[model samples]
Target: MSRIVILAEGSFQFHAAKTAVGVIRYSKDTVVAVIDSTKAGQDVAQALQTNFGIGIPIVRDIREALPYQPDTLLIGIAPRGGNLPAAWRWQLLTAIEAGMNIVSGLHFFLSDDEELRQAAEKHGVMLYDVRRPPEKKVVANYTPHRAGSHTILAVGSDCSTGKMTTMLELEQTARQRGLNSAFVATGQTGIMISGNGLPIDHIICDFLAGMVEEMVLDFCEKYDWVFVEGQGALNHPGYSPVTLGLLHGTLPDAMIFCHIAGATTIDGYQHCPLPSLPEMIRMNEDAVNWLHPHHNSKVVGISLLTHHLSEAEAHAEIQRIEQETGLPTVDVLRFGADPLVDAIQRYFNA
Candidate 1:
């Protein structure tokens, strides 16, 4: 059995740690332990109950938790303002000295922080700064109707967020509009689609050469519109660039980009080592410039995944993105009945 210890101190780290546990729950080889210094000597049992409603004990220090001999120590602690804390730096060193492989979602762990990053690398540890692949349980019995045209509203953030629920709601919205829409689980996990209650197969695995073209062509022949949901995090393994490439090749009539706006979005840009959002917009412009020569499809608009944001905050974020990128942005939640329905109608018309 492989033991994995998650070191969490702050609220955000605690949530992220729990999410990681959820992602790896199916693995029989993994055992997870949560460590928090503030809660030391207290009943790990009781603390877990209060914090996460779990039975895992919250040990006070890493040394006390070391008896379990975890093979992997996942550091859920992040540096304030994107800088690793001095104490956490020492704790990571201690973990390595204790012979545990370390993994972290901390930006510094993933960044070019030479001192700490190099130290961890020297210990032969794997530092994974990437988001965990979404854990979607497949409903094997779910078989979608073989329709001629179907619209799939796959919702997920470019980062970890409420993509699943957004996708589900989009499906509901489609159904309300009298469109035969389905929620497709292109992510690694399977989700139950509304209406038909069928399981949206993960196209990453199920799709073969020409399979996408065949599916799209068939759906167009049978259904009025097909709404395919995109996955969260463009870099996630479950997020197949190839799938997006295929969609582009097949020439979808319209494309909608969903952006999840939360307090995290403000700092997300700092954590992302890739091109900034502005750069991405520029790249999109360049790509559009080249692709539009042969293809003809409009980038319908950007939708905000506002699961927890207030109306004002959501609107502000949308406005910011619109102002920055010169692309129309809509708050998916605020669009409500009239605007969402109208957008759907207009999308189909385009």
Candidate 2:
């Protein structure tokens, strides 16, 4: 396992810092430090406002983190367009000069950058582009999910709305109930936690659905239910393609609609207001139906991320959503996933 020093820099704990937070929570790689100049001299827990139960220092730059002896420098921020910022280049160059390998999930491939490429070659360090799709030619083949595999896909109102977290929580709840279930991780965070999964967004659009279909089919014989971790939102202008592919590919029986309470718009796109919860539900249903008209998928539950709200406010919001949608609803993390799990069990009459 590589010892990774995350370069989150200006974006720690914010939406852009999602990849950083994921590594902090799930990476098997030793996370010696996080390079966030804004949060320098602070513990990661303190900066994030949640105790990770581990000590991870936040430093100002790569030089400050060198003492921790990280072999890999992982870029943990996914800015819009997946472009590497001009300001971050110097620090990244410094890390490469120090013989640290680079790992990035951005669409802007580090290997494509001449300076980064030459420096890495000079230092004999590898650059792992996590989001680059496989080069081999492939075709998208549609197949309905086989019966008896009660699959649930965690579709969200917007990107970074806790789809992965909800899926993991549901899977954990299933295990505690002694039911046979498996989690199908489709992103970096989920893959790190589960130790295996395809990064669906990285794949070319033509093969995205086929890849999901293959993954779901592979898991069917082994588990009674498979919870697929959904990607971007159908309403998200930037990431809707991957979202639609996962919906059509998995063709799940049920969906747990995820939304961040009080979020009027997407995290970065303030100008683009979010559609109503009912509309988001309809969008997902329409996508699934368009792919598999026979598969009558419905939103079975609502998973709200209420971390920004007070406990009472969250509870009230939960009640409001339940009353409005006539669906079981809960904040998966604030309260245990029991309500959501019970909702799904009730749906399947388990």
TM-score per model over all chains = 0.45, 0.89
Tell me the tens digit of each residue's lDDT in model 2 across 141-254.
665556778889999889888898889889889999999999998986677557667889788788888878888878877888899998999999888998988887788888
**What does the lDDT come to for candidate 1?**
0.49
RMSD of each: 11.7, 2.5
Q: Model 1, 1-350: lDDT tens per residue?
A: 55877676543232344334332332344545666777655443465433333555556667777887788776554444445667666766777777777665443434356765676677777655432322443222322324444343332235444444445455567778777654443332221122122212223333321344444455556566665544444433444354344333234444455555643332245564444545533443333334444334444455666646777887788789789756566665456434444565675555
Cα lDDT computed for each candidate against the true fold: 0.49, 0.85
Count of backbone collisions in candidate 1: 18
lDDT of 2 at 298: 81
Measured by TM-score, the strongest candidate is 2
Give per-residue lDDT, candidate 1, residue 239: 43
At residue 20, give the lDDT of candidate 2.
85
Report the C-alpha displacement of residue 165, candidate 2, in angstroms. 1.9
Worst 10 residues of 1 by lDDT: 191-200
